[model samples]
Target: MNTRKALYQFGYRRSPDQDRPTPAHHPVVVVGAGPVGLCTAIDLVQRGVPVILLDDADRIGEGSRGICYAKRTLEILDRLGVAQTCLSKGVTWKVGKVFQREELLYAFDLLPEDGHKMPAFINLQQYYLEHALVERAAQLPDLDIRWRNKATGLKPRNDGARLTVETPEGSYDLDADWVVAADGARSALRSMLGLSFTGEVFEDRFLIADVKMRGDFPTERWFWFDPPFHDGRSALLHKQPDDVWRIDLQLGPDADAKAEQAPERVLPRLRQMLGHDNFALEWVSVYTFQCRRLERFVHGRVVFVGDAAHQVSPFGARGANSGIQDAENLAWKLALVVNDAAPERLMETYEFERSAATDENIGHSTRSTDFIAPRSAQELRFRDAALALARHAPFAKRMVNSGRLSTPSTYETSLSTPDRDAWAGSARLGAPLPDAPMRDREGRPIWLLEALGGQETILYVSNGDPPPCSCRILTIGHDLIDENGFFEQRFDASPGSAYLVRPDQHLAARWRHPDSSMIERATRRLRGFDGGAA
Candidate 1:
């Protein structure tokens, strides 16, 4: 009976100097090969933008870090052509339970609706995710993924940025019109630029351990507050693929992180929690919670994404999810800017939008941390009372904040054309379009997202003919069949309502009985051509 863990290897072949000469100038160079960097490069290359992706390491991540993938992230990955692989290799769950000292307090279902293409969340190891993304990236001819290519120096210019990379063979210099820094939290490029990363650092420490065992625990998130097994501390348990379980134990400020991570200390805790030592320890790490972000993500020609731009506590699963969204939000804008389809100011919107999202995630994560590990005795009393009352009262249950799960950020920017009509819909302007089940004209079952190509799409849900437009037109009830009535119920569609969707699938504007001039105005406003909102 073998219990050793198997690691994945993505062989790195040295690039031949004769065949891989440094280009005079590249359109884009991504400075990390993690999820965010790989996503950026894939999205750019799919849009006909050549990209050079550099990674300091040749192997996947060491552990199963950042295991939760939100629905919006799955949608973005679906666009990159690897969502199916992720879905197949991940554990899908939506229900979560909160307990107080062996007593169940409340339960929640993140996604209670049906007819959506993706679930609320999926738990897949970060290594598996990166492997799938790297495999997908390798299939693209426009993307050049260079392993073990470490960026040592960055020189920012008025026109572009020059990067000095160190490889196994030797050092080489490369120039790019734009540089994306998807590097980790301790980004060397970020340090070289001398930018300030400001935020709050909590004194609390947390122990994350991954154990492999044969258990019958259901695929759900279980959170405990002051559980009896751990003796007045918080704990979180989640099921992942390959029969691996992730257990997070909250350690007070006075506890030594290094000592707690030792096998002797960790095994006792596991035995107490599991009532036996049937599981094998796979990986363990100790970390302090922090909520921090750079002042600005765009540093002239060098742009930062993912952990390089922002970081938050692991409570809400926002770190990797937000970083991937940052890449999705920036890739299309960068492509448009490089191809001269939009103005340089378009890049500013990325900084503005993602910064706002980072702040939101930080705020929520901070609140969850405070609730989970209250510093003051008075705070703990209130948390206890809330958990006790949550068993019977619905209001108290809502007040219980274990982790306010991750969701897509809706941008409130000048890019979105203002709604011109009195509309009532759950999908608002500047928000990502809500997915629904539909059928294509050929009677094949499809999703609303499936019909939405990678461009500005116009969704008209009416009987009248849509206006003549340059973008793709999707007329519901005609071009697509509403088999489940989800469109009308979710979108609040009227007889002549029209929706303008951006390239990133966010709703830009909507109109009631809009003519060709009105549609054109909205398009122009979205592209930053029109001065006024449509």
Candidate 2:
């Protein structure tokens, strides 16, 4: 067996059909073995859900280039329990230098020292990320990852869904209880469902070059703004975990695909940016892309994820991270519904929450690009000036950094809701709570992230008598909570105010004392389980 086939069999374990008496179909059919597809499959298989993951590619390549693994993406991988393998070889960028003109204004402390949900950002090539995910998925006894298998006619059936699959071996008929169309922006599945991919295709083309070098570059992101190097368009310089530098050059509007991508043309751009005196070009590709997303991520039993669900400019690195988050959110909910833990309608929330997130992230990445790398000269100058001011001004810096690297855009219509007793005040409404530091019984500062334990919980900080509920109630201070209730000291919040947080680390409601039944109502609407457990 080839390295990939061997690793997959040993890792995710997708067995090839022997005699094939029209083999029985799986419960979940994931079409697209990209990062999103692979991640989703791994989650399902590990959870004991039978799944069949398919990809159009002969191998993981072309269609969706999986590059630039961010910090949030790493955290998601860590949650999968296989991040160490990737981190051991992926690039870690703790420091990044943001530039304006010729001056190096301020370096962004991208990674926080406090315990992270996962390791900081790692720069591993897409190939490696795919290999790792595929390996993990293969190890699952319930997963069947088929290579060189392209899904054709996908139609939902009465009790389940049927598909016309074309494999290198032969054509076959397959059936599944569920189908996920993660085929990407130009998803054949989405088109087959007559679902409209709504959004503007921003006319932008970028040329990406990956080169292996012997010298050492800083373990930080270097962004040059309208520098003398690559003409007017901005140049982003980053180091991959494999000691390869990924350099991007914004192609001009009139640039030709054929003429521009010639090795002669690409090597010159690299030479210009790297001082015309150094650097080597290992791999090059010219990519033309637009920002677009589907109006509805679901159409009956077939669901969409990753670029297939939505496509955004890779400015804030939110595109892939959001995709991974979608995979995680849908995986658990799908498992619950499949096992009858929750109603089938619960799966609808995936559309509600993820669609909302994709919309916001699209706007964020689009807006960041105008500043990160403007299209025109006038726009570039305006962005250059903005960065110059933000570098010196605290407020400006905070605003820019918060929007760029920071998450928590807000989830107003999520299916999961907080208990009314958990509700404290506005602090609990649609936002991530600000963190404060305090020592634990061990005398070391306690991290709120650790308190989360990767699940939904509540933190009630009240001055008056503490109310009762089930989900992780930690009453801080001497109010009615007790001496052990002093957890408020950890986040430096008010002594008597209680805040309700959700499983995804976003706040639900907050109040100083007994106020309203808003939290309880929301919780009921989400899980449908009325009582809170101790």
Candidate 3:
């Protein structure tokens, strides 16, 4: 047995619902306690909504499933108060190099600028990430995480949903005002609701080997196309915590999955690639190319998140990163609806925004899949030519896709008010609000994201007092001082520039010398009350 499982496992215990005279009710019931489910439940509980998170297993599953957590995900974790745990134990990196054979095609830095709280990416084992989340969830009284509890059945309703849970002791029915199906790709709840996915499944496989070794390799992403050790196939290497290196080797569609995972076969490949025999295998698995998503993520009362809603190729680390974004996207919207602060139509925006995000992820994952594994001779020739040109030409280097790393999604939805005035900064109207360094009135340094918190805030960048508004007002020059001028440069903040930030830390709308009414209208538009025509 894996030591991580033994150390992190939670014993199955009977729930109060199992002994209740009637089906116990919860404000929200989250199926699957993976990263997504745990995050969703924790976010909801933090919002004052009681949540019951159920998982069939008691431990973080075997293998370091997803190791690359993007900076946006780290920001979400920061909001949830667990970013330090992940950062303390994860490998932080930003540089990545793509190579064709021994020749380096190009190298890219994910985050060229500084002053952000989090790095460009962190390579931590998924189990460690989940364990951190589970620990944080345990601190929230409203979040009840039930281990050894499998969601065997789901009945959707207009008001809520009824869940049939199977436990080690017995089966019991429970009621919830809303159900989150974060049960992974083969979601039992999704199946119970007779929902199916619609997308493509590429006919190629890859071997993921987590090997433990003390190497002098830098913490950088190194991807190779047709390397000498593994000719005619792609390979990738990433450093994880505990000196565990993740190595992925492309295996053709015809490769036997079972045989390839065997240590006898995997060891030889590693020996050739590393040119040494000082490594021990921690975990190994085989996976195929799959980029698919459900037609609709939201049903009547059941909402799907994470892999349950969409599955993308592991290349570019989009799988878990995108799923974490989905959980953040749903948590705030669902909280508002459940609290009656917003109408049910608010949840529909969750569907609209995240579905579009899924589409973008799928498109990128599929393109990366194609570029890594060309389907035909013509495609292969084009890819080879592109790689050859990438060695010298900058434009061709952009074409060399070794899985475009995951970035935050920009939602062009009704919740966001389109920009009326021209903006000169990276903070787009519908995109994530970029982070910068600032200081409070006391001159103590702070990060922009930490100051924003989780609220609909009006960021007025002026030395003068901000106009009164419905939402909280953060006066830039008064409340926060841009010590390095990064905030002003990144936001293009003139004296009277103002921005309306959403709860998820996204830019909803912005203006130049906006009045209280404009801020109110934008706030209403953000909350799904207004038509958002303006």
The most accurate candidate by lDDT is: 3
Which residue pairs in candidate 3 have backbone atoms (N, alpha carbon, C) closer than 3 angstroms, thus clashing? none
Model 1 C-alpha lDDT per residue in residues 101-214, reported as the tens digit of each score: 898888889999888899999999898999899999979998988888899999999889998888877777888999999998999999999986899999999899999998
Model 1 TM-score is: 0.97
* lDDT score of residue 527 within candidate 1: 75
Task: Residues 111-198, candidate 3: write the lDDT tens digits.
Answer: 9987888999999999898989999998998888899999888888888999999999999999999999999999998889888999
Ranking by TM-score: 3, 1, 2
Residue 231, model 2: Cα distance from true site in angstroms: 2.5
Give RMSD (Å) of candidate 2 vs. truth.
5.5
lDDT of 1 at 500: 88
Residue 149 lDDT in model 3?
95
TM-score each candidate: 0.97, 0.80, 0.98
Cα lDDT, model 3, residue 420: 80
- Residue 51 error for model 3, in Å? 0.6
Expressed as tens digits, the lDDT of each residue in 1-534 for candidate 2 is 001122222222234542467746678899988788888988776556889887766565332245556665665576565688888887777677766556776777765555344545767777777778877775687887776677788787756788877765666777888898888767888877778777766566778777666546687777766677766666677887555777777786577767766777887777777754365565676665456888888777888998998887765567667788788768877876777766777777788888888888877766766555466899766765666677788656543431264354455654534433443322335654444343444455554544543455556665466544655665554212223323443333564555566544556555444333655654555553433321
Q: Which stretches of candidate 2 lie over 4 Å from their true place?
A: 1-23, 61-64, 276-278, 372-381, 387-403, 406-409, 414-523, 528-534
